[model samples]
Target chain A: MSDTKPLVDVRDLKEYFPIHTGWGRTLPLKAVDGVSFTIKPGETLGLVGESGCGKTTVGRTLLHLYKPTGGEFYFDGELVTEKNMPSLRKQMQMVFQDPYSSLNPRMTVEDIIGEPLDVHHLYSGRAERREKILSLMETVGLNAEHATRYAHEFSGGQRQRIGIARALAVNPRFIVCDEPVSALDVSIQAQVVNMFEDLREKLGVAYLFIAHDLLIVHHISDRIAVMYLGRIVEIADANELNNNPIHPYSISLLSAVPIPDPRIARSKQRIIPEGEIPSPLHKPSGCAFRTRCPYATERCAAECPELTERSDGHLVACFNK
Target chain B: MSDTTPKKAPFSMQIDPALFEPATAEEKKQQEVMSESTTFLKDSMKKLMRNPLAVFSIVVLAFILIVIIVAPLVVPYGYSEILKYNGMKDKTAMNLAPFQYSANEQKYMAENGVTLFPHIFGTDELSRDYFIRVVYGTRVSLAVGFFASLIVLVIGVLYGSISGYCGGRVDLIMMRIVDVIYSLPDMLVIILLSVVLKELLDGSKGIIARLGTNMVSIFIVFGMLYWVGMARLVRGQILSVKENEYVLAAKSIGTSSPRIIRRHILPNCLSVIIITTALQIPSAIFTESFLSFIGLGVAAPMPSLGSLANAARQGMQSYPYKLMFPALMICLIVLALNLLGDGLRDALDPKLRK
Candidate 1:
C-alpha cells in the first residue's frame, strides 16, 4: 500500500439536512460534520458507531449518493463534481443496508443486475448482455436459473447477494457497503463475510464497510474509524484501535464488545456509560463527545481537539490522549 | 432422482466434490415452469378475464362498436332523409312503432315490387329513421366521451407527475392551482365557454368547425374541468412511490431525473393511473349525456342520445317508448363502461384484489 495514491480521499466532508421547524423557518441537522478519511486500493476501512451517529450518512456522502453540502472528494486522483458523476459512478457503487427496499420489486434479477450496463451502453447486442448477466450471477454464487426471478422470490441472504452482484456489475474499484450483513441471520453472516473477503482477494476491490458490529468490523477491516455524533473520534489499525483505544468514547465503545470466551468476558469491566447521545440539532460546544466522555475536563469543554496523529499513525481527537 | 457419478480425479479436492453436484433431475422435471409471470398487469388481466361481469361488459361494448360501424352501411335510410312516395311527401309516418311501415311505404313497395326495409326502431317526430339516428347518436356520444377522457388523462399525468416529483414551492403552487380548478363551478364554466366558443368557431375554418360548435365546446369544457382528479391521484401515488429506495438507487447510479421519474416512479404508480383513467371515461360520458339532455350537446340534424331523449320528452304522453328506447341505450352504455372500469381497478392493483 506504500507509494500509491489512495483510491478514495475525502476531506472535510459535511452533509447537513434542513428540517422545517415552523412557518418558512428551518434548522440544520448536521448529520456528517467535517469528516475526513482515505482508503487505499484493495483496502477495507471499517466504520463503526452507535445508531444515528451518521455512519450510514458518511458512507452515502462518500459515494455522492447524498450531495455533500461542503467538502471535496478525489476518486483515483480525479476531483468529484456533479458534472462528472455519471462517469465517476462507474468506479463507485453502493450496497444498501436494507435488502428489502434496495431492489426494485417489479424488475427481474437480470434487469436489476444489467441496469448499469444498460445505462452505460456497455454491451453492443442482446446476446452479449445476456451472457454478461448470467456470468455475473455465477460470480455472485447465484444460479443462472435464478436470473429470471424477482427480488421477493429470494431469501434475505440471496437478496443481498443479488445486490452485491449489481454493485459488482460495473466492475467498480470501490464500494460503500453500508451494513450489508447486519440484516441477515448470524448463520448467514459468516458465509456472506467470507464471500466478501474472497471477492476482495480475487478482484482487489476496496470497501468502506459501515456497521454497528464491532466484532465483524474487527474481523474484516484493515483499519477502523469510530464515529460519534457525526464525527470520527479515533482511527487506527484495526487491532490497535480495538486493544489500545486512546479516546474516552472509543474505550467505552470497545468495552461493549463481548469476548467469545465466557470465562474472560464475564471478568472484563464494561463501561456502561451514562446519559443519552445529545441531539445533533443542539450539539455540545467544544468536543461533541465530551458530554459522554468520562475524562472530559474544563479545557476539554473550552476547545474542540483536531484529529492529530499521536504515534504510529493512530489518530485520536481527545486532548488528554 | 439419480445423481451423477463423481468425476474421477487423481488429486483429492479441498472439499467434497459431491457438494457441488446436481443431485436429481427430478428437481428440474417435477414441476413445469410457471406459464405466466406474476405482475400487477398480468395478474389483474387474469382476474378481469375470470370475472363474468367484466367480460360481459366488454362483449356488450364490442357489440356496440361493431353495430355502430356496420349499421349505416346496411340501413337504407339516411338519418335526416325525409321519406317520399309516388312523387309525393309521406307525412303520415310520424312516431311509428318499431319494425313498422306506413301505408305509403307499403304502397311504394308493392308498386315497385321491391321490399322496403321496415324502420328497425321506428320513425321520430320528423318522420326520419329513428334507428339510424340512434346509431349515429351512439357513435357521436361514445367518441366525445373517449376523447374528452383522453384529454383529461394527458393533462393530468403531466401536471401530477411534475407537481409530485418537484415537491416544494412548485408543488404548493401547482396544487393550489388544482384546488382552484376543483372549486370552480364546472357546469357554469362549461355553459359559459360553450356559448362563447359557439360564436367564435361556428363558421371560422379550423378543426373545431369540423366537430361543430356544440361538440367542440363540450371538448373544451372537458379539457378545462376534468383533469384535476387524475392529477391529484397521480400526485398522491408518486409521493408515496418516491420514498422507495429503488428510486434512491436509481439516482445513485447516475440516472437522470427524468429517466428516474419515467422508469422507476411511473411504473410503480401505474396501478393508480390505470384505475383513474378507466373510471374517468364513464365520468366524461355521463357529463356529456347530461349536457346533451340540457339541449347544449351536439347541434341540430347531428343526433346525440341526450338530444334524442330531450326531443322525445315532448311526445312522452303519446310515444312513451320513444323516450324509453334512447334512455335505455344511454343506461346500457354507462353501465357497461362503469362495470369495465371497476374491473380495471380490481385487476390493476393486487392490493385491492380479492
Candidate 2:
C-alpha cells in the first residue's frame, strides 16, 4: 500500500441493533464493534468474513446507510460529518449481494441506473442523461436497449451487471461492492468479477469489496481484512496474510481454502477452529474469539488484544501471536 | 480459459456481447406486465360476454336506469294528481286488472281493448302508474350504490394504510375499534336511525312540509354503514404487504414513509382495492333496496324498487303487476352488478394470468 492519503479512513466504526424485549424495552446487539480500515486510492480492500460476522454491516455503516453507533470516518483527508453526507454520497456508491433483488423490481433499468444521477443532479438534459445511462450500461456489459425493461427478467449475472452499472452511473471514485458475485453461478462469477476488475482498471476507482469467499477476495483484493464476531482479527497484504497467517482464526481460515494443485492440497492438513462462534449479544469478556481460539490462554481471556502491526504491513490482534 | 477467448481478439479488443444477445430478464418482465394488463382488460370483457345470464341482467338493469332517469320527461302526470271519476255504483274499477274493463260499461269508452290510457306496467290500488314508479326507482338504487361506495373507498384506503403501516400498538387500537363496530347490529342501527328521522320529520312544519323529507338522505345512512367492511379488507392487505421485502428495501434506502406508502404500497394494493370496491357496490345497493322494502327505506311514493315491492306486498292478490315489476328490477340490478364484480376479480388477480 502507498503511504499517501487514503480515499476512505474509517476509525473504530460501530453499529449496534436493538432487540426489543416486551413493552417498550430494548437491548443492544453489537453488529459492528470498534472496527477500523482504510482504502488507499485505486486499491481494493477486501473484507472477508463468514455470514453475520458484521462484514456487510461494516460496508453499510461506512457509507452511512446505517447510522453508526460510534466512530469517526475520514473521506479524502476530510472528516465525514452528518452535515456533509449528501455531498459525500455523490463520491461513494454500493453494489449489493442479492442479484435477484437490490435493483427495484418496479423501476425500469434506465430509472434504476439513472436514480443516482437524478439525486446528484448530474446531467444537463434528458438526452444527456440517457446518453450517460447508455454509456454506464456499456461499461458494465449491459445492453443499452435493455434499459426499458424491469429487473426480474434478467439472469443472476445480468442483474448483478445492471447493479454494477447503477453503482457506476454517478461516476463515483469509490464503491462498496458487497458480495458482488456470491449469488451468481460458478461460470458467471468469474465473468462478473472480471468485468468489475476491468471497470476498476479503466476508471481508477477504489472498492471496499465485502465477501465470504476468501479465495475470490485473495484474487481481487490488494489487501485483506479478516473479521470475527464484529471485530477485525487480522489485516495485511493479501499474499502475506494468505502465506503466513499469524492469528489462529486467520490461520484456520487460510488453511481451509482449497489449493488448486492436487499435490499441495493432499500435503496440507486443514486446521479447523474449535467450537461455534459465540452469539454477539453475549460476547466473551476479553477477546471475542477466545471461546473458539485453540491458542487461547489466561491472558487471552483476561484482556482484549489490540490490533497492532508486527511488521511493515502485517497487523494482527492476538495475545499468542 | 484460452478456449473461451476469441483467437484474433487481443486484450481490450473483444466484441461486446450484451448489445447483440437476446433481451435480458428485466425487459421480458416488463413486456409481460404490459401484455398482462392488456390481457386482463380483454379477458374481463370476454368473460362478461360469455356469461349470457350476466349479459341479460345487465341489459335489464341498464334499461331500468334509463327509464328512471327519463321518468320526469316521459311521465307528465304529477304523483298526487287526482283522477276525476263520474259516479259509478261499482267500486271494483279502483282495483281493475290493469288493461281490463267490464264490457257492461256504456259511458266509459274503450281504446285499444282498454279504457285506461298509458299504464304500461298497470296501476296500483290508488290508480297510480306502477310503470312510472319502477322507472324512477333506478335513481335511488344507483345513487345509494355510487355515493356509499365512494365514501367507503376514501375511508377504507386511509384507515387501512395508516393502520397497516403504523402496526404494533396503533394497529391493535384501530383494529379493536373495528371489532367493536363490527360486532354491533349494523342493519338495526340504520333502521332505528331511519325511524327516528322519519318521526322527527313528520312533526316538522314550514319548508319541510313543502319538499316533505327528501329521500336522498337515506344514502348518507347507508354510506356510513358500508365503510367498516372495506376498512377491514384494506387493513389486512396492507399488513401483509408492509412486511414484504420490497417494503423493507424502501425503508433501508431511507425513502420517507409517506412516499413509500403512496408510490409503492398503494400501487401494489390497487388490484385488491378495485376488486373489493366492485363487490361492495352490489351489497350496498341491495341494503338500500331491502331497507326500503321494509318501510324504513325511501319514504312512500318515492318509487324505489323497495317501495314498489312493499306497496305490492300489501295488495299482491288484488294487484300482482305491482309486485312483479319492482321485484324483477331489483333482481336484475343485483345480478348484473355481481357478475361485473366477479369479472373484475378474475381480471385483477395477477396470478390468474396464463
Q: Name the top lDDT candidate.
A: 1
Could you give candidate 2's per-residue lDDT for residues A1-321 as a string of tens digits? 578889999999999999897798998999999998999989999999878899999988877767889999999988987777767776787888887757655566787777777656789999999999999899888877778766775789999988888778777888898898999987999998888789889998999999988988998999999999999999999998988889998988888888766667899999988888888888898999988888789998899899999887889999887
- Highest TM-score against the true fold, candidate: 1
Instruction: Report the error of model 2 at residue B33, Å.
Output: 17
Show what share of the native A-B interface contacts model 2 retains.
0.06
Local accuracy of candidate 2 as per-residue lDDT tens digits, B138-240: 6677777777788889988888888888887999999899888788898898888777767767766776565445354465565566677888888888887
Query: Per-residue lDDT of B1-354 in model 1, one digit per residue for the tens?
Result: 225655544563335655686748877776545434455556668899988889999999999999889999999888778777656667878788998898888877788899888898899988889999999988888888888888888999999999999898999999999999999998898878777877877787677767677887788789878899889999999999998878877777777778878877887787677767767776777777778877677777888887888889999999898888778887888888878877776665534444
For model 2, the chain A TM-score is 0.97
CAPRI quality level assigned to candidate 2 from its DockQ score:
incorrect
Report the C-alpha displacement of residue A28, candidate 2, in angstroms. 2.0
Question: lDDT for model 1, on a 0 to 1 scale?
Answer: 0.85
What is the C-alpha lDDT profile of model 1 across A190-224, one tens digit per residue? Answer: 88888889899999999999999999999999999
lDDT of each: 0.85, 0.76
